[model samples]
Target: AMFESNMLETKQREIVINDIDPDALEKLILYAYEGRLEIHQDNVTNVLRAAHLFNISEIVDSCCKYIEKQ
Candidate 1:
């Protein structure tokens, strides 16, 4: 991995995010950084979708459990 080897890599990378809401993306990043996420009725579906796309099983499961309890 060039990024892991620190070879021939730029300092910045460009990522294009579409379809997902900005607020939901922000919350997902926050969850990734802090290892915790607070899922609520309003954002659950969006967050869950993001989690599934990103292959984040923990968040996906959390969202499912939250939905089940609702």
Candidate 2:
């Protein structure tokens, strides 16, 4: 949604996400392109939150499944 908004037409064309952890954001980016992600005990919560914030249902479901299995 950020990219779809007018922000992309701005001079910088950059979307700064300050609420999410940098590591989680990195993992989310990796998942977006790779279609795969590793959700470990330490990062599952962070990943889930980021995925939900971005409305990435696949990752959110995966994270929930991982949590249920734990």
Candidate 3:
């Protein structure tokens, strides 16, 4: 979800990207802006990969914890 300016909305909107699955790109922005997400059995790997690519420390730690649960 990018926070860039959009003429469609009065203010910036949380745009859901279609080309990229939410799992692959959601956590970086979500964790960066909102600081949380339910990373569980289903989408943990995708989130982890996104976090690693984006170099978000909090997200990386969260992903590690999810992995350890298995």
Q: Can you rank all candidates by TM-score, best first? A: 2, 1, 3
**Least accurate stretch of 10 residues (summed lDDT) in model 3?**
1-10
What C-alpha lDDT does candidate 1 achieve relative to the native structure?
0.83
TM-scores vs. true structure, each candidate:
0.76, 0.82, 0.60
1-70, model 2: which lDDT tens digit per residue? 5446676545465657778988888898998789669789999999999999989999999999999999
Question: lDDT of all the models against the reference?
Answer: 0.83, 0.86, 0.69
The residue-level lDDT of candidate 1 at 42 comes to 98
Per-residue CA lDDT of model 1 for 1-70, tens digit only, reads: 5457655453448546678877778878999799879789999999999888878898899999999999
Residue 11 lDDT, candidate 1, scale 0-100: 48
For each of the candidates, the C-alpha root-mean-square deviation to the true structure, in angstroms, is 3.4, 2.0, 5.3
Q: Pick the candidate with the highest lDDT.
A: 2
User: Judged by TM-score, which candidate is best?
Assistant: 2
Per-residue error for 53 in candidate 2, Å, reads 0.4
